[model samples]
Structure formats: structure tokens, C-alpha cells
Target: MSKKQKRVLIRILISSVLFAAGEVLIITGSNPFNEASLFAFFLIPYLIVGGDVLLDAIKNIIRGQIFDENFLMALATIGAFAIGEYPEGVAVMLFYQIGELFQSYAVNASRKSIASLMDIRPDYANIEIDGVLKQVDPEEVSVGDIIIVKPGERIPLDGVVKEGTSSVDTSALTGESLPRDLSEGNEALSGCINLNGVLSIQVTKEFGESTVSKILDLVENASSKKAKAENFITKFARYYTPVVVIGAALLAIIPPLLIDGALFSEWIQRALIFLVVSCPCALVISIPLGFFGGIGGASKCGVLIKGSNYLEVLAKTGMVVFDKTGTLTKGNFKVTEIYPAKGATIHKDEILKLAATAESYSDHPISTSLKEAYGIKIDRKQLESVEEISGYGVKAIVDGKRVYVGNAKLMEQCSIDFERKTTPGTLVYVAIENSYAGCIVIADEIKEDSADAVVNLKNAGVKRTIMLTGDSKAVGKMVAEELGLDEVYAELLPADKVNQLEELIKQKRLYGNLAFVGDGINDAPVLAEADVGIAMGGLGSDAAIEAADIVIMDDRPSKIVTAIEISRKTLKIVKQNIILALGIKGIVLLLGAFGMATMWEAVFADVGVSVIAILNAMRALDVSRYQG
Candidate 1:
């Protein structure tokens, strides 16, 4: 706990004990109304509960930080005491202190929510060297060094497994709540807990570049990025306290000299009631509490919002655009079909092996899939004189035989006539020793939940869902139709995506906010250009998190709908609290100024409204109970 919290807790305890003792004495046939006895019965508990506020007011008087709520509350209660209303004075302080303690308690609840997300961060890592497990800082471990991950332990780094296999639980990172199978040559990331096996992994990234550490950093700094609301109460206090103080001074001095029936003390008493009623505590206390609850709730559901600014914008998003590559697809290419064209000489395995070897030195998606499909050992040493043709494909010599691998254009240039086939994905033809071989069709598979995500967003009141991709129009249309998208803009470069966003923003309906969801490195510009940028499938990419406004931590496209629904609900609660606090305070302030209400009523106007507003703000944290 912070020092301020400890001090507040101690004061509450002291007040609780003193108040109990005072009640006991008053009930035990003691003479309690005497100055000495009444002082003990009322003043002791009041001082314990409200002494810090009084002290703070005095300090502010010395430091020229006067005219705040502290001074108003302190002086009003002192006026109550001067008028022989000891119990009323004591009640105000007690209620105010209870409100303060509840404020602290609410903040602690929100902090606990943030602390739960801190589970992904590891305190230390185990580095294996020469068959020995040595404890070391993650930063000191280099690439290719084998790290040991034990059962019930989070993976400390992103690495490829060199030994052993395990069912690793990655729910913390993905929120999918399923354990993924891992074995030799499979990749694993930090924040995944080992379920039941000992695995030796070759670290691929530096500790500074690990995914869990970045996520922790994001969650820690998310609040700082959120912009605050208008803070209407603090603004009211800024002007109200000084105005009331000045008006009371005028009433205390000028009115007594002019009016025949007016006593300066009576006007001063009225001024004290006015001050007590105008503390502006309700708005000041509830706005921050509402945001704390909202952020805490989002963190629990695996949606990390950087600040209140994004939270506000998320509520206004009208059109949500999705990038077709990684955001809407699996982002991994797989062989969907193997077609040996009519009169083709080589079979499926021969075609796959030739293409895999010819494209071995390339890093494109189709090349990687071809390498995986061969099901044979890839010895780069055997394929000598390998060369990559920029944006076209590759040319290499496998066992002294010239091999060519690329699109139909490259194959046509090499004089290899391979018949075209009906395929919705990227297809590559292969030529072995200048002889025409069969084709291997590789397609970027649609995400498992893409259709459901689109449907859910529509149900969540999103008017339009669009897909923007660089792929051919035919392929883009096919994917869009399957996912039930409203529109598809294909063959778009990075600049073209921005153009589409501008057009959508111009034609946007009621909310006037358009969102673009993407995960590619090139989509950073578009992410920044949109009104609300949703980065989907952003597990380990820093660029996606930095450029986007809302990050779907688990890369689920459906989270976009979840975030919007949560934002809509949270914003509704926040506004309700604001209206509720002001409505109650406005009526009570009028009654107190006319002398129809006591100091006790004024205390409720100040502290009672605050407590209710705070309770309402807690609704933002209960998204599961509220969000469908």
C-alpha cells in the first residue's frame, strides 16, 4: 500500500474506535453535554476522521493553495461547531471520511484488475549451458542459446524447440483457453505455461524483444495514453469555491451594515451552509473512478486500451475496415489441392520437391509452404548456385540440374508450358531440368472465426464491414462473399488503403468514425490514418500495438465487436453517473442555501452523492454481467 493509503486506513481505525467509545459513554448514564464531556464524545471522533483534511487546509493556507474543497468543508463544519451543533459537525466529518475510505477501496479494486494482467511477465528465466541449467537475466541470453522451460512455468523467450515436446497452455497470451501441442522444431513464445513436458528451446529473439514483456509494458502505460474527460466537478469547484467564499464575505460584512434586521453571524451561518453544500466532491470523485473501472474491466477481458481517449473514440466507431491478409486470414499458407495437369510427366511429390528446392532460398509465403509440403530433409548445401528473382520467384541448381520456380510469367519465360488450373489462391509452376512439372496451389486460409466475427459486429450495430487487400479482385471477392462482408476493395497498395479510408470517412453515417483493422508492417500508415484503428492478430508485433488505437491482444477479429460493445456499455454508465451526481447535488444545494436543510443534510449532499456515483461507476467493471 501507498503511504497515503496507510495513513487514511490508520485514521479510519482510530475514528471507528473513538466513535464506539463515545457511543458507550453516552449510553452508560454519563453526563455527556458538558464542554469537557461533549468534547470527548464528539470532537475526538471528528478529529480522528477529518483531522487530515483540516491539516491539509491549514497547509494550503500557508502555501497559497487556498480556496479549495478542503477549506470549504473545514470552515463549514467549524461554523456548525460554533453554533453549538456538535453532533451535526461530527456527523459531516464522519460521513466525509467514510466516503474517502470508499474511494480508496474502489481504486484498490481497479488496481487488482491491472495486477491480474501482470501474470504474463516472468520474474526470471532459466538458461541452459553445456547440459547445466543456470539462472540468468533474460537480457543476457543470446540467440540460438537453448533455454529450459519446466512444467507450470511461463516460456521466458520466443524460441524454436530443439528438444522434447509438451502441451503448452497459451491462454494467457491468446485468451483461447486451449493447450496447444508443441514438439521439436515447433515455435513457442513467452507467456505460454508449460503443461507437462521438459523442453529445450533455441531462443530466437532477445529478451528485450520478447512478447510478454512488451504486453506488460503496454498494459502498464495504457492509462497514460487515455485522455481524461471534462471533469465538470473539478471545474465547478475551481470557480464555485472562490465565488461562494467571496459572496459569503460580502454577506458577512456589507449586508450587516446596510440591512436593519440582519445579523452578521446569521449571514455567516448561512454562508457556512452554502460552503458545505458546494464541495463539488461528487464529480471530482466519480470521473476518475469510472475510468479506473473501465480500464480494469478491459484488461480482464484481454483488451488493453492505452488511455481514455481511445476508450472514448471506441464508443463512436461506425465503419470497421479489415485487412484481408493476417487480420482476416490465418496468415499462413497451406496446400489446399495438388493438381497434376493433363499430360504432365511428374507426380504430386516430384512437383512439390522440385518447387520446394527451387524456392528454398526465398522467404515468400508460398515458398515456405512448398518447403513444408515436401516432407523431406532440406539440405541447402545440396541445392548450390541458388538465386532469388526479385518479386518473381527463384532459379537454382539441384544436384547440377537447373531448376526454375515462379509464377506462370516466369515459367513461360523459361519455355516451360504448364497448363493453367482453377485455383482461388496463389499458385506456382515448377520446371525440373527444363522439363514441365505439375503445379502446387498455396492459399492463405481464412481465419476460423472470420465469418462469426463479421456477423457479431453487425449484430453489435456496426453498419458496414469492408475488406481491403492487395490480392486479385477475384480472390478478394471470393473471401469477402464467404465472410459476408459488405464491400471488398482489392489490389490495394498501402496508399490505396488510405484512399479507401478517406472515402469511408467522408460517407460515414451517424457516428462519423471509421475503423481500420490490420497487422501487416505496411498497414501502420493506414492504422494511424483511420478514426479508430483496430489491430487484429497482434500477438507479438510492436508496430501493430504502437500504431493502432485498440489492440485485440489474442488476434481474434471478433474482439473488435467485444471492444465496441464494452465501450458502449462503459460510456453509458459513465454518463449516467455524471447526470445522477449533478441532479441530486443541485436540489440539495438549493435547500441548504435557503436554510431549510441542516449540516447533516449538507453532508449527504456532499458525501452521499459521491458514494452513489462511485457505486454506479463500478458498473463499468462488470462487463461480463452486462455485455452479451
Candidate 2:
């Protein structure tokens, strides 16, 4: 509880005791109204509990905001006092205050859940200055400066490890429980806990540009972007409160004048009850609170929803489009197959070694895979006069021999008649001195959870799941078939991906939206063009994260299903609160107008419904167990 809440709680306890004693005295005594001392004693407790509400009502009235719940509550209680129902007036105000306290407490608790995500911000960074380690603010650390991280300390900036090896816990950033192992030359992002070793790291980004700071900024400003449903409630209350106030006035006045048997006092009492029950407190408080809770719950599960508006859009998603490389697949290439031509006398390992040696100076992923497959250090001194062909591959002189490594086009240009390998992967053609050597096939491995992600999304009511990629048709078709995707588009450039997304958006069902998931720098345009852009944040580029509407911190495609489920469940709770509040209020408003209901029922209709709806909204916070 906050300090203000603690003080309000104390006041509630004190006032409840005094009110109980006053009630007993009133029942035991002859006439409390005739006794000035007893009347003043009861009024003291009333003011003690409800002074803030009364003061707020008056302040708002002066500010020209007269139709809010505070005004309704204050007016109804004062009306009770006017009618000489002092006990009823005091009890109504007391319960109203209690309801407000409950609301404040619930809101604060939900804020804490959302705010816990901000704990990743580091308090300080450790930098060595002339052999002396000094602690300073992370903002003071510059790029390229070497910083040291000890065991159990958070890495304060994004950087590369220069020395030492350790396991770092990334659960706070990624929501994955496993600790990632890091060694020299490995990259380490901020907000990760260095688990077991003292390491020296070269800072690559300043404090503001780090991943932790970016996430904090995104979360802190999220609430400013309201969902469509929340905006409706705001406008609904603006008009609804004033219309009810006018209706209560007409009920109190026109009925007494029109009906022959209607007494002014009875109709006035009904009008007071009407105003109390008419306050739009339940709808106003619970709808946005529910969205806020949903965002918090998603963050707990390693998904960052940019705003409530995006959450609303995600619930309406019927189609999901995916990028191939780093999204559904691991993005790491491996040499899975090798074929030697009939006349080539080289072994499979020899073919791989030649390709690895020729591509030693290249930093492409395919190059890396070839090097890794060779499993031996390359002698860079043997590679000479390397030239990169933009549309194909590299040409290098290896060990005093002219070696060419590229696609079929390079071999065709070199006049080498090579046997074309038809496979669902990237094929590299190697030619020695214009003679066809062999081919090495490298393929990207799909993620284990990707198939499950497709199934779960389908089960969650997604109409279609599609894959878009820059790979060949065969490779795209192979992955699509394995994952059971509905459609696949291959050999698309960055702009083509956006065109496909636009077409998919047009194909969506009326009221349904399209979501695009990606994890590469080239995917940024498509991510921004889709209705909901989801990024794989763990290994995704900064451009992708900046453009995406939601980020899966762990880079698991299955989390998209979890995110969709959270959105749907949150929308369900919001709709429930709306229906429950409106239904109960509508029925009781009729009863109160006809004199069938009393002031006690009016209090329940106003504060009781609000408390129930608020409790229902709280359910959106516990969505960790919600699975598609």
C-alpha cells in the first residue's frame, strides 16, 4: 500500500468504529436528531470518512466538471441529509469511500506489475580508468570503452566480451530461464545478469541506445496510446453522465407535477436514488485497467506489447505472415549435404575445406557455415587476390591456384560445365582453374517450436498462416510443408514482402487484421506495414524492434500464440465487465425510478457493481497460465 492508501485505511478503521458506536447510540436513545451533541458526534465521523469526496466534488464543480461520480455521490449523500436520513447518508458515503479505496489499491497493484519490467535499468556501470575500477552512471560510459562485469552483476551496456568466459542469465530480458554461455568475442546485451565470472567487455552502445533503455522507453509511454474500446468508454461517460443528471432532474420535477398521486418528497427521493445509480464509475475505471493489466501480463511472459491499441488489434488478427530466416528458422546455416562430380577426385571433406579456405575472408553467413563445417582453422595466408562477385560469390587464389566459388552463373561464366544440384538449400559451385570441382549444400535449420506455433495459432482461430522469404521456391516450399503453413511466397525482396502483406491485408475477413513476424533488418519495412508487427527481439536487429508493434523477447515463435491468447482473454474480461455493469445498472435503475428500490439498493447499484467489475478486471493480470 502507498502512504496515502495507508492513511486512508487508518481513517476508514477509525471512522468505522465511531460510526458503529453512533449507530448503537441512535438505536438505544430516544431521538438522536433532537440531541445536538449526538448529531454533532455522528457528523464528525461522517466528515472524517467522506471529507475528501465532498471536497473533490466541490473542486470539480468549480472546474466545470459537474457530472462525474464524485458529484453524484456528494449530491446523493447531501440529499439524504436534507431528508433527515442522517444514518443512511453517513453509511452511503462510508461505503462509497471504501469502494474508492479498493479501486485505488487495485490500480496501484497493477501498476507495480507493469513497473516491475523497468527493474532491468542498471544503477551503475564499472569502468576501469588507468588500472583502477571506478563505478559511475551508465550514461557516463562511452562506446568502445572497456567495462568490467563481476559475478551476479547486470551488464550495464550493450557490448562484446573481450576476455573471460561465463554464463549470463537473460531471463529478465528474454523471459527464458536458461543462462546463455558467453566467451571472449561473444556479444552481450544490457540488462543480462553475469552469472559466474568476472569479464571485461567493450561497450558498443551508450546508455540511451542500449536495449534496456529502449524497452523502458517503449513501456513507459505505452499508456498514452489508448485502445479503441477505452476511448469509447471515455466518450460514453462524458455524454452518459450529463444525460442521466438531466433525466434525474426531470424525474424529480415533471413527475410530481404530472401525476395526481405523486408526492414531491417521494419523487425527489427516487430522483436522488436515480442519480446515485447512474454514475458511470464502473465502466470508466475497469476498461483501461483491464488493458493495462493485459500489457503487464504479456511483459511477464517475455512479450512486449507496445500499447493497448496494438493489443486490441492483435485480438482481431485472423492472418499471420512470417519471415523465413530468423523468425521461424534458427537463421544459422549448416552444410548438410555435399556432392562430388563424377570426374572430380576430391573427397567431401576436401571439397568443404577448399570452399572454407576460399571464403575465409568473407563474413557472410554461408561463409561462416562452411568454415564451421570444415571444423579446422583456416590458413589465411594461403588465400590471395580475393574478389567478390556481387550477384554470385567469391573468387580467390588459393595456394598458388586460381579457385572460383559461387553459384551456377559463375561457373557458366567461367565456361565450366558443372552438374546442377536440385535441392532445397543454398548450393555453392566450386571450380578449380575453370574446371567444375563439386558442390556443397548449406541449409537453414527450422526451430523446434515453429510447427507448434502454427498449430496453436490455427487452434486459436487464425484463418491462415503464411511464410514470406527471399530464398528459393524449393527451400520456401520445404519449410512451409514441414510447418504445415497455408501458403508460401519465395524469392521476395524487402519491398515485395510489403506488397504481399498489403495483399494479405485486403484478403482478411472484415474486422480481422493481419500480423507480420520478422527478425531481420530487411524485415523492418514489412513489420511496419502490417496491422500488427511482431519482432523476435533476442536476436533481431534494432530496426526490426523499433518498427514492430510487439516483441517476443525470447525469439520463440510459439510466444506469438501466447500473446494472441492474452489479448483475446483480456478483451473477453473487458467485454464481461461492460455487460455485467450495464446489465445490473439498467435493471436497478428502473427499480429505483419506480420507488421499488431504496437508497441501500442505490448504493449497491453504484459502488457494488464498480467493486465487482474492478475485481473482474484484476483477472487480466494473472494471464501467465493462459495458453492457446
On lDDT, the leading prediction is 2
Local lDDT at 548 for model 1: 66
Winning candidate number (TM-score): 2
lDDT of 1 by residue, 1-628 (tens): 6677778778877877776776676678674567766865778878878888899989998999887767766876776676665655665666556555544554343232333434456767798667788888777889888889888888989899988877786544542222466778889988788877788899999887886665555444443443444434446656767886786566557766898998888777766666666655666566666765776687677776655556667788778898887788876778877777678766888778777877777655566788887868887776888876543567888877788887786787778777877678777777777776767788778988899999998888888899888677877898999999999998775556666777877876664578888875446556667776677635524555566666777887877877887778778877887788768766876676556778678768877887898889888888785334
Span of ten consecutive residues with least summed lDDT in model 1: 106-115
What global local distance difference test value does model 1 have? 0.72
Error of 1 at 199 (Å): 39
Model 1 residue 604 lDDT?
84
TM value for model 2: 0.64
Off by over 4 Å in 1: 1-229, 232-262, 337-339, 342-350, 357-365, 374-403, 419-425, 432-438, 467-478, 488-509, 520-531, 536-540, 625-628
- Report residue 137 deviation for candidate 2 (angstroms): 35
